[model samples]
Target: MASAVLDHDPPPKHLDEDEDNDCPIEQVRLTVPTTDDPSQPCLTIRTWILGIVGCVLLAFVNQFFSYRSNQLSISSVCVQILALPIGRWMARVLPPTIIRIPLLNWSFSLNPGPFTMKEHVLVTIIASSGSGGNYAVGIVTIVKAFYHRGINTMAAMLLTQTTQVTIFTPLNPPLKKKQFLICFFFLRSPVAGIRLGRIVQEILGGFSVHVCDSIQCRALNEEERRPKGGLSRLQFFLISLGCSFAYYIVPNYLFPAIGSVSVLCLIWKNSIPIQQIGSGLRGLGVGAFAIDWATATSWLQSPIAAPPFVLVNVLAGYVILIYILMPLCYWTNIYHARRFTFLTSHLFERGGAPYDLDRILDAESFSLDVRQYESYSDIYMSTFFAISYGIGFATLTATLSHVFLFDGQYMLKLWRQATSKANEKFLDVHGRMMKANYAAVPQWWFLVILVSMTALSIYACEGFGGALQLPYWGILLAIAMALFFTLPIGIIGATTNTFPGLNIITEMVIGYILPGQPMANVVFKTYGYISMSQAITFLSDFKLGHYMKIPPKSMFVAQLVGAVIANACYFGTAWWLLTSVPNICETDLLPPDTPWTCPSDSVFFSASIIWGVVGPYRMFGPGSIYVSLNYFFLIGLLAPVPVYVFHRLFPEKKWIRLINFPVIFGATGMMPPAKAINYNSWFVVGFTFNYWVFKRHKQWWGRYAYVLSAALDAGTSFMAVVAFFALGNYDIYAVNWWGGVLDDYCPLANCPTEAGAYIPNGCPQIQ
Candidate 1:
């Protein structure tokens, strides 16, 4: 059957001498092998064992990091790194016994010949799938910390699990239709529909037998046809890990100030110029490390993940806009930037005090009481926060327009091919493998999951007083919203590595529908936005498995297992942290140097207040200070038209195609959670790696660059996780020296006062 699948397509043609100089997509397609060697072992006991261990480790680490002030997420790259060696070791040590299943007529090996790249990738993917920090855990945290409501551990776990599980519901109907048609035609038996539907359910739920076989088939063929030499997989993994270990010390412990520097302050300090510059330089160093660490797991994965030119374009825009334009705007006090922090999402009063939500919400219900809100003084926002809203609105419009303008023709062709009989030609190596080896998941199974999860969600919401008592119709609306936006968001994320968030839109829509009910609004938004995002994430993983030639059934089992493990681990970890750490998320109660501030949850809670309790109409409607900001939507709609027109007029201006406006503006609002130094450092690293190294040394870049990225991310994340449990959780300090302390070296980095002014907040006055 495998041999028959291979015979369908002729071997891929060799690339021309000039192929390297072609477009990035074309170059990647030519250079990288698309399929794995089919003869190698894929599913084994070793794979499952390593996968389970990796999943547990990564889930715990991710949940641990979620509460930290710096908010470092453990990337899937960590799993990829650790799993490679384990897999190789297993291949060597495990007995090569072929186990035969009697009635199923299937046979599998305890040890595959050598742990193939496909198996290694599959193990990593499964582990990494579990590494995503569960967002539902935040619900428990927020209720405990901010709302002062305590839900039992069992209830919290159930809520978190059910919310995540229910997201699978809305996705099933479409998947079922597609899978059933394929299964019916392939099997030539309507009765097999029940069997196939189960398989489809597994696939949808993140298990698969032949998910990545199509892509791997091409890769395998390429390897046989032309064996290009590079570093061995083990060698590559080791080098990355070694580099990461070495790089970890600089940013993490030795020179924490390297993460962010107040450049202006360094130049202005006449008495301590050398000391100031040294501190600033350290910040730059840390920033660069952070940039490399972040990029490796995200952008530097597969060459096809993000094209080099696209990275260059983003760097260019970010540098020009953020470094140059934003600084100029700040200096000139445009949008009153000097009166507030240069970058923060937080709203502020005109006098620089934080916007108080308690003033607007009712004392008991915690919902917006219009009469009380009207009586309070008018609210003001930091210039950046206000600008973020405008840019966020604009990002959505620009993204939609850009997609329609650039990808419309291709999408149309794809749709046509999908609908027509010619879809067979479009099937990749993985798809072919799936057809040959795997049975389609059954449709009814998805229906069962969907119905059960939906019922559980409704029961939890309505029955629990502490939880949001959202009506059944609101839940349905959330589901509908998720369904509607999933495709568009998925398209953007796949193509551009940018997701124009549905959170804002979902909040706005829900706020209007259920005004005065802040809790319900948040609940609605969570279901609508997070669930949709989760669906996209799951689908993307399925695609990754497809690329690696993992069997669809095995992939399904891995994901199901990983999900369960993650739910338990995340809940336990969160509960432990909340209990152990006093004044857990309260920055004021803890020592000033503490790292326990839940930055993400703070953002979430604030957002709930702004969009939910206060409502958008009062905030951005007529007679409001932010009324003019609403015009940004129209501005955003029109922003891309000129670019599209210019591209048409000069079809050869390829750079125009690279101008991703959404990405450029999307980067502007990342200040409070992310500092300016991060962006500056990121640009420097991106230029050095993606632009200089890639252009000058193509093969070396392709082989070593992504590996290096994976290494650094894993090393830093692992070390951080270790440090947290070993020292951070205990509130133990390494030393009381300058290097050991947090970056107070740039105290004036976000000072609201003018450079020469001092308002008794302990910031130095400019001479």
Candidate 2:
């Protein structure tokens, strides 16, 4: 049986000529699989297919309006709110395959099995908790302090960092996967909180006994396992909060030294002892200095050479090969392995049941099977990108065009799957059976939420510190866009998030195109803030995938769903909150002095230069610094030019290995040298602590460590929120229980001065 399973290899793929499978132009076929297993029945959902089509169509339409009416603001609310549900519905109904021509066949299907009530609640909770909102709120608090309370940028930064690490960091763990509304409601409502606790006890208490060893499974009946062999809930929570507080200090004060050390430690500690981490760190350091040197030199020489050199630096062969080429190939395949092959395998073999090995091995068996995607040929790549670019441009063409390209497909596929299973259970040849682990979420609840969003937009008009305010037209457009653009962004396959609406808004407000619009000013002012929020969501998804053992592809798809839903729901609620509560938008609850107040003049001039002038350096600003460092360090190692010259001059000895090691280290040593050191330190500390407790003393710390960390973050956030409200951060309350003492005795330690609390304005901006 093992031999047979191993022997089954799909057929060598042929280039697909299907119209849908053709390349778009100037794009590389990064993901091309050369296998085809035909025995399995095709279960492609059309919703995703339609969703992609809808996005392209809508993008084209948006482009048309952008050109004709010369207004891009029409699609803002529409694109953000309903994109996920639309995508989900489309994926359920659309054909599952997304084929491309030229020696490739890959899967981009939208069959994630059945969803359950727990999954729905879990997703909604996670989406709504304002995961990104915390960052936005932090920025707002700083800005408010700077402008309203006459504080400088340095002081504001310090205060923000302190507040974030100490207060908000600890609270994230318990609330990470919950809905934002639920968190607020429970925290605010005493009666509802009590009721929820009772419900949890009644349902879960009886279930804990059988699985008493797991806190997550505390629902099982067993008091012995509950909080046993570990710290109590309160203790764990505080620890997480403290850790979060510590995190704020590292980036500012410790990054320089700690980064390189961490890399070096990883190299020393790893079984292979490769200097991969070290090399990456050096790249960052060199790149940072290189920019400074290049900028200084270019001004001294001809300015013409600057543009070409800048482009060369960015698009250099080494940079492209290491960063773009390798990751595109490896990550894409890894994504497939995780999403299609890994996750579904468990489902196929559940309960010692026999599965159709042939069906399971089919190349087209996965979601969004694209038969034409085979090889990384140049022509194919160019064509694929052209199509993508075209779709983006089309968003500015006509509204009808917008509907065609951006419509959701995955949602459609799911809907059909549900319908099919309603009539017949999954059965394979020889009477074997296939089943889903969880049941689907009820349709009624889904519909009710949809209706509720619509109702709120039309009526309530505001929500949550006046953070939400969608006009009727905006809400309508959201419904339409969501109906179409959902699947491509949400599911697995050859779909896309053109970011068309955002582009339109940017061009209108920031560019020279549109003359005036009410929201245009606001859009320009907040675009940078918004981009960061989006970036965090993307990175968080990647991190979650790394930890949860979810198939990479499935995680990617799941994340898209989570992201789209959160973007829409969060924005809508924010709008409503703003409209409901007047003057709140003027305060620290939201970032003030943005483009929203004056669209035409509030162009993001500084941001434009940051993007155009110092291109690659921008990645070094926040979450992206580590990745950039890694890539440049790779380039430094493989640069060959200097090494070749040195080898020629000294022909007597063979020191290639030694020379290679130094060069690699030099490059890695440049940027994040501190990271390596810190990582090593933390690892050593962790291991030593573990050894002392577990090996010598015979104690287990695993039971409590991770949970404790998570609890601490959540607990700290809870306290911070209470403190923020109480200390007059917002208009919630006026009595400061700890404020007086902090001011008198601990002035520098988070005391609220006339310029607001805990801000240190000493650090310089990257630019």
Candidate 3:
């Protein structure tokens, strides 16, 4: 049975010219397979072992990192780096005995052959699934850290595991043929039983045969298989690690004092020109570090990673909009930017005090009491945040316009081609592999997952008073929203590597639906936003598996198992940190130097208050100072029309098509969570690698660019995890010198006013 399933002809030498020409440029150009090795062992014992271990490590590190102020995630590059050696080592050591299932009639060798590229990729994907902070951790962090509520660790683990498991289950194949055959045999009537038996036999027979039997699966040469100018795995891993270690040590330990320098503080220092020069140097150092960290992983993964010119356009947009425009706006005091310390998601009163929701909440229900809320003064936002709203709205409209203008015809054609049975042919090598080797996930499985999770979510919300008592209708509405936006968002994400987040849209909708119920609003938004996002994520992984020539069944099992392991590890790690770390998420209790500031959670909590408790109607409604911001949506929608029109009118002018308004507008909001240093630094790094290196040294860039990205991500994340547990938790200092201090070296970075209206800590008094 295993031999029959594994059997395949050599891959085709040349792709169908007609099909290739018809394919969208992006899809056709980048769809090249990683290898042409037909005998590559995909599902093997070594792959499983490495995948499981990688998943656990990644999950723990990701969850641990989530609490830090910088908000670094353990990138998938880490797993990609770590998996190669382990998989190969296991392949060498593990026994190769062929194991056969008794009733299933399936037999497979434990080790298979040497660890192939497909196996390595599968392991990395599985590990990546486990790594990175899951949204479920937010519930635990917010409940325990902010609300000061007690949650059972076991219960939390169970709920999180169940949620993740159910979410990924829809990606799996249907029940095995044996189970269906067993059911079919129970028919009482002889005629019905005979008919059903024949149908079942046909199905079973089909499952046993290989789909590649009909198609020619010819092998290609190395040049044909992989893109030219790429480095080996080892080269990327080692260099990135070295660079990442250097990056972490220099700013963090060796010269911490140079990390952040403020112009205001320097000028205030007794009118010393040297002090101003020192401040500029400090800014340069900090900006360099920020750029190094932010751009390392992102550049490698961006859609224009290989294309220098396209990357330059993106960098241009990022630099002009974020670095140049935003700072100019701030300096000019546009929208009263000087009145706020930071442009964050946090809500504030008109007086710039933190909006105290506890003052208005019903003590027993924890819901907003209208009478109490009415007694409080009007809520206000910083100029930065107000602009963020405008940008967010603008970006959304711009993205839709850009897609419609540039990719509309292709998208429509693709959709029609996908739905039409007559033209249903595999367009690429990966598509052919999918058709030849695997059966798609059944629709019924998706329905089952949807129904089960919906039920579980309702129970969690209503049954547990502490879990935010959201009604069933709100949950239904969230699901409907997910269904509505999934296709459009998914298409954009797949093509452009940019997902216009549904956070704002979902929050706005749910806020209106269930106003004054902060918990309910948040819960509804989570369901609406995350469900579709996760689905898209799973689909991407599935496509990745297809590209790597992994069997669909194996990919499904790997994801399902990886998700379960990740959930458990994440929950366990989160619980440990919450208990073991002293005064987590409490700035007052911990020393100023502590990394466990929980900035992400703080942002989440603040968002809940703004979109959930106070509601947008009172904040951005009629007569409000920010009411003018709502029209930005229309402005966003119209902004891209002209650019598209010009491109169409003068197709020969290549420069006209270079302007991507969505990229520019989207970059404007990258402050607070991200700082000016990050933007400035990211631009420099992006230009150096994506522009200079890619254009000047194309061979070297293609070989080492992505590998460098992976290595840096792995090294930094691994070192961070090690540092926290080994030295950070023990309250060990890295020699208290000026260079090793934690401050951005900017005393007046926040720009505090004379009225003490926006006085953040460490700012100098203006006497």
Candidate 4:
């Protein structure tokens, strides 16, 4: 849907009438400063050194944690915070020496006055190279761990490089129509998806940037003073951060059960049915809550940053999907729902046993064996996992239709305003100032880079032993897909802070066309998915520069350099662990206490098995049990129609306009990884800060809401790293009391609800 409430926001009159307060988006008008400092230096010596170091540090730390079960991603916010004091220190200690290249007539200074906000922003942009954490590294992990195959370093590094680079360029049209025929053969039920995709592309006419990032960067630039008797922004942030750091030790370590305590589980400790209703991680989570910010905002994020309506709509949708619909389906035993646990992501065989994935795969080729598969039972999943996919399917179409119906014309206006010089006066004052001040990066840069990367991407898959059987034609389709979805997805992500991926769609297409090639499927999925996501990141960086008034050419240089080094470091780190760490990611072979499970990569490996090896022909093709779910396309396509009509019927009813089916349906989109505690706690905090406090205490909320969010994130990242090293790494230092367990004291939540179901490992089964 329209990501945030900024589409048609009325400009506020708090600022002086003649000032630069005429930005179309209200949040930007409110947060970004009206003036610029043209004399302030941007690309100083402090910027490059700090940026490069931050990029390497983040890449190493994040990749290190990726293999552990308790994964902690260090964000660019961390660099934004940590680099400030060091930057100020460098500004003081370094000599004011001028360095000039006489041949090129270029000059720069060592100590460029006090470190400027523009410099701080440039450093964060550089660090952002590793912020998304190299999506292609999972290919290295899954191949080494799951497939047990050795890869060519050149091939792996090329795959990593291409995925890390995000580009948006027009491509040469279909070379041979014959290749299109082969792709078309694979488009069966996904043909139904054509309308869904068309719905999104129909209204792709605007550009936006991450609203939350804008809010966070306010600290680095703005010079406003705190009111009388109020804490300064830095003091308030440090206080809140200290509190966050100290408070985490309780719920995250000493008293873990408080992280997600379910009242029903505590009251009826022995009742499986009651526990099933209350278990936060593995069940319905009827009365669950978490005190820990890490647990509460694990996947949902700190709600203090979201708009009130966004939080309410998401929570409303989550309750309907998880509490009402899922429980009903489970209780009634649809598709043998009770045969599995309530909230698991695991696949199962019939009769309640875990699916033996290796049993159906050919050992040598890593492809599905029809003979072995015929003897084995059909694939089954928890009702939660199956239904969630159906929700995702509907959400895509709903997102497309909702955006088109609600936001199309406004976005079209923005596109026109952005492109034509005649409409430049109507543009935001910030945009006008940026254009006036900075030399723009030449368009030819993108053209040259796109051609070079596309060529390398092809050679990475095809030239390497022809092992990755993705033909050159597949790359063309992938680029086409990425170009099509990038703008639409970017709009939603920038506005709502929610980014939906094309991994599923990409895998479905290639797996169907070229089944039995695992690397090909995953590599293609990486290309299709990461291209759009990284491109969005690239856009967000530019927007950050846009708001901060950094020169476009300087920003371009910073990003290009950072991305290259960060991509290399990320690959080097993953490759080092894969080669040196004994039995890494192999849980059975490692010691009982080993912490190298590669949880995300395990899921990635499972996807390769599901889509690549077995292919859609077996999973969702004709005669498949899930074939019925293909109708979600029709359901989603029609969902937004009612909302659109209602708005037309009664334009005065504003709340009706706020009702977004995609936001609600997509609320449960992160369920496989996110628990109910995340959603429930997020909604409560968001409502308190953004709604109640926003109206009740306007001054305080405006000054501290986003600052508080940033502090909490930074503190949590720091503590997580400390906790991992101090206590989480060893059994001896871990808390020994009953409170140490993180679950809601609901052991039975792992068991099946069906009367005659078999339990794995001979766990007690109900009769």
Candidate 5:
């Protein structure tokens, strides 16, 4: 929930298109469409036909792009836009004949009158729901590609020493269709958080990110509520979209150096220390910068959408942790830091070689081979990677503490207000219309879903002959975990847009209990953590339905049907890609400059090995080298207390409340999947537009900043897909040239400092 304090639109300095904000925007001037048609056809043939088409297409497209190093997709907004013309055309061309079924006493028409806004909303709900890529699919990637395959992409850097060791002794190399099919049933729970989130809600909720999406509907929808001058929103959006699309080709395919230009690396090309300090991908990235939107917005969400305060707070923590703390830990050779690379998520041996799973892993049990492990070297990490774990431990506790300290009153007030008899009075026209015009979905419907999903979850866990390994009681415990965190997480999310995930806690808990079983740990975390995320998203969709005045029953049907169909498509698409893609997630087998490197899946696998296979006890238990990192949890818990006290003591100093420990600690959470370049470039862009522009040109910033962010995302995503199809995928691959790939000319950055340490290809031995 670090992004919980990401951004919020304060009291508007200027009026909306047809609005004067005399009342608070949250209270009275919410951006929901004021007018609605009670009789507008919502769940007609048009919605089903169009929704299914969009859902299936997006499900395929999103899943397809996810494996790329620079992931991009045809966004749901694109579906929203494309769905309009197709929807309208279907309404016009289809037969208007009505058919009646006398036995059931039901009647329906093939053509619903001009595709209504409610139909549009339902279509969107269905398609977007389907396109939310399944998170549990990562388990498939880990199992099929990383663990059982005996080869996986290590990182951007490769080792000279050769070893092809499967992380798992033997599961199935190719995941049986049944294994992934089980995950599909659970995909109904957490679609939105898996792939994407809406932008306007993100800004208001304060966690809007531009990652995974090039085109966003949030800006368009919000801008529609505002007055247009000169170029219209669409006109400006299209223009920027075209510009960013064209510009990305340069950095993305042609001159990759444009994406990350480290002056220090360029100036001192032969100096190992200089390269180590300057490489954006491999090293500290002290003076790195990028003009590319993809790199800038990859890790952190769009800076353009963030407020000045949010950017500053994040920048403060980033500089302090990365610049100040990381360097100190690494340079001082703490924990034998000099034995490993300067910064990386990959684990290593004490002797500075990649940790060989073949040596220490028990082939039969998928557990640690204690005897072999003792004979082999202990697992170690780069100083930065080690610190990242400490940050994660701290972030989880800090999120809860920060919420109670700062937003407790607001939350309590909201709860009281919600429970009070006067709650009905707060209902706006949209809410009242939803209540009056639509029959509410019965409570039993939810109970049925809950019971059925629970049963399926248990079956997924244990029905596979203990393959998934989670007990039935473990399923209940997971649900209970979700139930426990839901209210607080919901409150924190509702109050602040950021959702602090329970992945860490869940992993820690399950690791402590079920140490040897790797599958159980990740599966438990998925149900506990990802389940809560999906629940929040489900609620958010309901809120949107209410805002659009869609029938409650229609919304329910759309969501359920969409989840089922979309999830199947999501699974089918992923299965196809996993089976078909040559080498898949294994960079060891793939050709150089290949785009099929699965960075996220690699991180997920690392996490499974650390938290699940080895167990947290082995990694963070007593007698472990990094046991002190656990103290960060306590540190995170109390970190907010001082800030709260300071805020209380000096009521005048408004800045103290901005100190978000969750954001600070959690900032590095994405480090492995993300790297130094992503963070450095993201901070630069976020600071530029949010702080510099917001201060100097509030009017322009308010009008076009969000639009530009969305447009860049849209343009970049479109181009990426195009580039992949045209040049990067299949036999074509990225063109060979100095400009064809991203590099900071810092080849020695990943080299270790200790004597006898070595790397592959060009990486030098330290001796």
Candidate 6:
């Protein structure tokens, strides 16, 4: 259930030692250097200090340009532009690619571009922001706004998705492609920052940086070098076509039976036991049926089968329990990893010539600890209700406060240790200072590139779709806000700051400004969705860098370039066309009602108030009760369930399994059901599968399953892109149901109906 976007990818290390290959992995070497005096300055901190300060100023500048006059919030666009300059700075950590520009000498750093850890991180962060954040925000908003009747909203949203195949067939492929690409890139991109950071360190320290044919050099191996694998690319294309065709004709035929079967297959293949899967499926079934039934049952108390209120409470309880307990518990694991580093090598097993676990974990040998926790006891009890309750009470005065803030010294120590290990493993030396070898670009040069890229993207998105107005600026602003707000928070929220509440707030803004226009609404929603998706993608990559001891500064730049490439190649053109082209409905490939076009302004408005205001109240007042009550109950539930279940089943030495209970919290929190599962049914299926595959088949499943899942995801995304674009699925349809169905119906001469043909409002002047 964790967002794939937020999960860090494994640092690639190729085993085949081929001299003729240009694999970066071949160049990478792991060596440990002598530790120096702790008094010496850390370049990583300096880079962040400068970058952070510069970024805040950049954010203010972007805000100035965007919010100056445009009520629509062009600040997002400014943020994107601002990133270019930051990107340029980030590029120094990349390999310098010199280009012949006739009279002008041109060179750019491919640090975050091509195949690099930073590229992976950026894409992952962004994607997490979108996919993980989207569902989280949606669930949270629905819960907050419709607390008494939130089931209706959740049902409505699900119902809306049911129509996704029938209504937005053209858009789904593109959306899916982007999602897949971001995930793919994160999983595949190889080492970037460590090599470049080493070079930069050499430059700053005036140490000679040299090229080598050694298999241990700090570069991605040939197999992992290419940003996109052929298989993955082919898969995206195929999936796109498959989804389009399925939407065009199969939905009405296939969804009834095939959908359920597919869900079962996915569940079965995933390794979940039938029993647990059944429990989850049962919950989902009750939820799905009850929502619609409740709505039907509640029309002036006209009885459907059961009372609507009963359905509401049951569904709400399930949702609340799932979101609160499952996610909360799993987060305990993530928190445990973040807070108490027993050993990086122990927590994560990244295979391919295993680095010495002893060397990696030995506290005396390497500074393995970062973000010092008060104690292992604190981390173990992060899920403890009473302790956290006291802390939560203090944080009530501030929305940003947490019960277990990582001590700065602890993080510094960890950073030093990670750096020491990376240097020893890759550089064979320590005490190398971080500095840029290349000169900084003039402000004007950065401006020119930024303007040019922005212009091209705008043209691609707008020149085609005359109907859907893509908020290019909003995308920029959102990125800027993410950069400014999330970097410091680190491992907070579901996945960094790509929290759903943030995106939902953005959607609400879109609704507030451009209400009644479904086309605009959807396009704007895409901007919010895509930005966050990439944010989490990038964040995950960064996490990988952390684990691998890659330089944080270099990773930062690689992520920026990854974002730029993804936007240009995958999302920019596709999103533009989705917005411009208006004939998608003619092919009967998609539904007419989408989140953007749904008659849900009330929902949006309510969400804005609830998440932006009421939900935040948990930090104070009676709202804190929810956090406290849930925290305690979760610990109690976790403590005994592991012991009880194992004891009841095995009846011998169940205490061995008792120790594994904390993992439940970590897994559940690290993986949220929202991002991981498409629907409630999938959640059940995934939970069972995860437990079965991970717990039972730890010997075989542990080693190969992650690889398989990653492979499957990469294949799925690759096929999606090719299939959608090559087949022209978005362009294949040419119908405007809203315009045609109600253009001449006995409404006014011209009306501005939201999306459906129903006369929800009086007619306005027809364009």
**Model 6 TM-score (2 dp):** 0.35
Q: What's the CA error at residue 110 for candidate 4, in Å?
A: 1.1
RMSD values for the candidates in order, in angstroms, are: 7.3, 26.1, 8.4, 7.8, 10.1, 22.4
TM-score of each: 0.80, 0.28, 0.81, 0.86, 0.83, 0.35
Per-candidate count of clashing residue pairs (backbone under 3 Å):
46, 197, 9, 2, 7, 106
lDDT for model 6, please: 0.28
lDDT tens string, model 6, 469-530? 44556435433443332322232222111121234334545555544333344444434444
- Of the candidates shown, which would achieve the greatest TM-score relative to the real structure? 4
Off by over 4 Å in 4: 1-35, 64-73, 100-107, 169-219, 222-230, 411-428, 572-599, 727-733
Q: List, residue by residue over 334-375, the lDDT tens digit for candidate 3.
A: 755545644355666656666776788776776778887778
lDDT of 4 by residue, 270-312 (tens): 7877888898867878898878776656655467766676787
Residue pairs clashing in model 5 are 1-500, 4-498, 17-227, 205-497, 214-713, 214-714, 215-714
lDDT of each: 0.58, 0.26, 0.58, 0.69, 0.65, 0.28
**Order of candidates by lDDT, top first?**
4, 5, 1, 3, 6, 2
lDDT of 3 at 88: 67
RMSD of 1: 7.3
Best by lDDT: 4
The local distance difference test score of model 5 is: 0.65
Report residue 451 deviation for candidate 2 (angstroms): 5.2
Model 1, 214-244: lDDT tens per residue? 3333332233322255565446667767777
Give the runs in model 3 whose Cα sits over 4 Å from its true position.
1-40, 98-108, 152-233, 261-337, 342-345, 423-430, 442-447, 754-767
State residue 122's C-alpha deviation in candidate 3, in Å.
Answer: 1.4
Q: Candidate 1: which stretches are off by over 4 Å? A: 1-43, 95-118, 167-233, 269-306, 316-339, 420-433, 669-671, 754-760, 763-767
Q: Which residue pairs in candidate 4 collide? A: 3-495, 3-496
